[model samples]
Target: MTFENPAREEIKKILERADNVAVVGLSDNPERTSYMVAQAMQARGYRIIPVNPNADEILGEKSYPTLKDIPESIDIVNVFRRSEHTPPIAQEAVEAGAKVLWLQLGIANEEAAQIAESGGLTVIMDRCIKVEDAITGPLKK
Candidate 1:
């Protein structure tokens, strides 16, 4: 069964309240989609924490090897990995007490979304953070 997500108003509320974002599977290569999206979000005034085992830093922020390695509380877990890899990441997001689990464009895992939602996290799938931000205007308090 597919779960209908929270309304746009609630999503906007969460986005506005979120300050720290953990970008899972982010890459150092500027040409990659993950890097480009991260750059865009950062430009939009969000604190982006890069999570990648392959890099020490990306876009001037220290990169963690995994979500668990990120010390601070994360408001959103922006997943850049494939659908098959998402359940574990979703679990990590839950364990880390994240409020949102965002699956980037072209990536969706219903099971992961269910798990995240079951764990009380807001789930956003098959969406681009940058596009959403641009279309929704700046997040309001």
Candidate 2:
């Protein structure tokens, strides 16, 4: 399965509009990329939900084991897991009613992107939310 990516303008719109971002595969280890990215997002005032089985807390917020465990509706699911592991996470993000599935820089899975898109979720692959935030602007109106 395959589909076209949202245009640069549309991707920017989605990123600018999204509020709560659930960071799947987030880690408590401060050295991890997910942790660093989540912290950056939080510092910029975006709600960052940490999803990791190994963590109870990260960046002073409660960590969830999965996307389904997050109480609030997530605007975007920033995936930090490997490409091989993204399909199920994408499925979970869809099941959790996320508006977008964002695979981090260097991570891309056409199958997962297709699933998320087919389920009415916007998909952004091989892009870093943190980088996007830096280059663009806050996810705000």
Best by lDDT: 1
TM-score of each: 0.94, 0.93
Q: Model 2: per-residue lDDT, tens digit, 1-141?
A: 445667777877887788899999898889988889998888887888989888898898899988889989999999999999999999998999999999999899988988898899999999888888777764443
- Please estimate how well model 2 matches the true structure, expressed as its whole-model Cα lDDT: 0.88
Residue 21 error for model 1, in Å?
0.8
Q: For model 2, what is the error of residue 85's alpha carbon versus the real structure, in angstroms, after optimal superposition?
A: 0.2
Candidate 1, residue 124: how far the Cα is off, in Å: 0.5
Candidate 2 lands at a TM-score of: 0.93
Which candidate has the highest TM-score of all?
1
How many collisions per candidate? 0, 0
Candidate 2 clash figure, as a count: 0
